[model samples]
Target: MKWVTYDAGSGPRTGILDGPTVRGLGAGVTLLSLLGDDGERLAEAGAAARTAPTEVRPLDEVRLLAPIPRPPSIRDGLCFLDHLRGCYRAMGRGGELHPAWSQTPAFYFGNPAAVVGPYDDVPIAPGCELFDFELEIGAVIGRGGRDLHPDTAEEHIVGYTFYNDWTARDHQLRDMAQGIGMGKAKDSAITLGPALVTADELEPYRSDGRLHLEVSATVNGREVSRGTLAAMDWTFGELLAYLSRGTDLLPGDVIGSGTVPGGCLLEHVDTPDMAGFSGWLRPGDVVSLQGPALGHTRQTVRPAPPMIPLRTGC
Candidate 1:
């Protein structure tokens, strides 16, 4: 079943998306709350909710919000070798893949407070001239667990959603030069939405031994990047297991699949066809990311505010 969180004049509420209309499950109910409950029971309740006579709202009449507006935690993983190689080469680092990448999955913690909805405006980072987007898929954790094995990690996932990992290239490079990690560069803004597709709904696509989902991004209605989830070097189960090592993962926690090959502008700016394109996102530019089972997330770029300087005290 497809689940959505939207506001219909009252407040954020949970609903099941049926065609172009959204059937309300309950007032004040949220995706996070549903995820915290038994997965089987939640599915049963959702199935019943879809058939019962309830308040139904047209999709256009409501404002869609992030499935879990404030997720418990956000972890983004770098699981695409093609994207990594391109980025390293573009940044003047060698194109050779890191040896550790083949043996282990790597990820970074993103700020949950910066999460935004599908149609929200993304403000350009102040003093940042090179803003970019990373097209990704996010797995939402259902059951909390620690020291989870790879074989059992899939049981902890409830559903998946589209993720747009916004980036300020300038700030990110500066942070890398100073060895300060992602810091403010990545924590500024991230979008996740449209709807969350449950694991059961996506089981058919898993027959190929990999998640066979197509991912693509468009800027101002012009398609730019494309890749497949099958390109991921690491699977979601592996990343989840790695994250659970000596750590506890709770319900409502989100883990991202990272950027697919050619998913970001930084990787394509030097290509022959894209050589004339400007690498930075401009105000009023709308970026839409779409996938097969997972729905689409569209974000409009808003003008940047005046840069706030860091105060240096004596």
Candidate 2:
């Protein structure tokens, strides 16, 4: 079932998206609250919601929010080999996979508080000129577990949503040059949602132990990049198992499937045509990331607030 957290005339509330109408799941029932239990219960609730007589509203009448506005934690895994290779090449490093990449999934923790809804405006970071967006899919945790075996990892996932890991590429490259981590470079706003498609609803897209979904990104209504989820070098189950090792995976935690191959401008900016562009993203640009199973997230780029002066001498 497709689940959405939206705000109508009142406030944010959970609902099931049936066709073009939203069937309210009652007040105070946020997506995070529904995720706090097994997917079976959530599915049951959705079944009831579909058949129950309730106040229904046009989908366009309500504003959609990130399925889990405040997820417990956000971890993004670098599971696509091609994306990594392209990123390294973009940074002037050779496009070769590191030996460690084949051994395990590499990931970074993202700021949960920086998350914005699908239709929200993303402020370009102050002093950032090379802004970019990573097109990815996010798996939301349904049940908590520790040291979960790879074979059992799929059981922990509840649903999926489209994710945009917005980045300030200039800051990211500078930090890498100085051997600093991605803390500040990636702490900016990340976007998720439109709606979360539960795992059961995605059965048709599963094949060869991987999801067969096309992922794409469009800027200003023009397609910029495209790739398929089947190209991921590491499966979500493997990433989840690796993440659960010695750590408890909590409900509402989000695990991203990294950027897909050719999913971001960073990998293509060096091309002759793309290099002519002055800024990576400008005010009024609309970026939309879409997947067949997971709904699309559309964000409008907005100018950043004026920089706050930093204190100099002590």
Candidate 3:
């Protein structure tokens, strides 16, 4: 079942998206609430909620929010080969690409509270010339446990969703230059959702030919980045296993599988060799991503305040 978090005339509520309608999930509003419980309980609750008479609303009419407005924890991994290669090449160290990254999933914390939904306005900070978009797949955790084995990692994932890890490259590079961690107040980079597709529902798509999902990003109507899910070096299971090693995996925790090759303008634009690449995403740009049965979302970029100087002497 496709679950969504949306605002009806009454307020925010969790619902099952059916065709063009959404059936409310009682007072248990927000998808995070359902995710807070284990998958079994979620399944039971969802079954019951379906049969109850609900104020079904037009899916397009209701205001859509991120499936989980505030994920309990957000851990993103840089485990994609395309992204790795692109980053290394940008640093003039293309030969330094590590094929053994599957053994060590590099990750960073993201702001869970900053997530916006499908058609939401992605505010672009002013005085920034390096707006970018990253097409990624995010795994939603359904249970809490530690030291999970890669073999059993699938058990911990309840579903998956599409994410656009939007970024401001100028500010990001500034932080990178100082040798500071990547999470330097980049609280606004994360965006995702149309709805969450359960693991069982998308399992068939995980296999070879069927796993072919196209990801494309557009600035205005022109395409900037395009790639396939098949390009990922490490499977989602490997990332789960690697992450659960030293930490407890809790319900509602989101793990973004980094970005695919050619997933953003930074991959091509930053290089003088690719000088002809057009301008990066800017205000009024509309970025969209679409997959086979997973649906798509178009978000308009809005102008935002300039990036504040990094605070020190705290």
Candidate 4:
């Protein structure tokens, strides 16, 4: 069944997606509360929510937070070959370091506090010249384990959700060249939600033609980058297995499956013919992603809160 983390009257809540309707779980219905336990608890919660006859809310009324809003931690995997290729081409770079694109997934930690609701505003950092957005799929871990075999990786997954790995290419390129990544790729750079669809419900999407995924990002109602899910080089299963090796996997952890090819501004480098294509995003730009089954969410770019200025005394 499809699961969602939503806002009830008081705070965040967890529920099952019954068509466009949402059926909330028992008291204390946050997804983290459910997935933080063994798989048995999750199943029990699902059953309870299914038969409880809860009030069904329109998908838009209640805000949709990241599946695991404050997941113990997040490790986004760089396993999509098409995205890697385009990234390199845009930068005039060369072959990938990982030949098979199967090496340990290159991942990074995202800010837990900045986790956004389905239709939240995304800050566009001032002075960032090349702002870009990516459409990705994030997998939520259900069980904790270490050195998990490839075949058993899926068992640990609880569900899937849409991700907008919003990026600032200018900062990223500068930091990467220095062998470090910090302000360039942290906190608030990621956007996720709408709801999490349990793993069992997403199995059908794994088939060749069934995935038929398409991602489109529009700026102020004009289309920019667009791509299909069929182009991903590595499947989610492979990335999970590779990451689990020799490392402890925990519940409520998120694994972001990088961006899709041509899914951002970096790919349209110095092209005049690409009208309405501007690399840098200014405040007031509205970005949105739409997929087949996953509903669409929009983020309006706004100025970030002012930072405290540093003072010095001689």
Top model number, TM-score: 1
lDDT for each candidate structure: 0.86, 0.86, 0.75, 0.72
Model 3 lDDT-worst window of ten = 305-314
Off by over 4 Å in 3: 36-38, 91-95, 98-102, 208-212, 270-278, 306-314
Tens-digit per-residue lDDT, 1-314, candidate 3: 77888897777888878889887777655566666555776787678657773667888789987788788888888767768777667657763655467557787888877788888988874456777788887889987778888777868888878888888777687778887677543667587788887877776666653345666766666666677666667666777888888889888899998897767777776666445545677677788877765677789888877655557621
State the lDDT of candidate 4 residue by residue for 1-314, as single tens digits. 77777875667778887876788865566777777555788888888888874566776577777667787878777766767776787678853545546645666777766677668888865445667777777888988878777766767888777788777776676677788655555555677777777767656666652345566777777776676656656656667787777888888888887887666777667556367555567778888887666667788888755644456520
lDDT of predicted model 4 = 0.72
TM-score of each: 0.95, 0.95, 0.89, 0.87
User: Candidate 2 — what's its lDDT?
Assistant: 0.86
Local distance difference test, candidate 1: 0.86
| Clash pairs detected, candidate 4 | 14-29
Clashing pairs in 2: none
Per-residue error for 83 in candidate 4, Å, reads: 1.5
What order do you get sorting by TM-score, best first? Answer: 1, 2, 3, 4
Ranking by lDDT: 1, 2, 3, 4
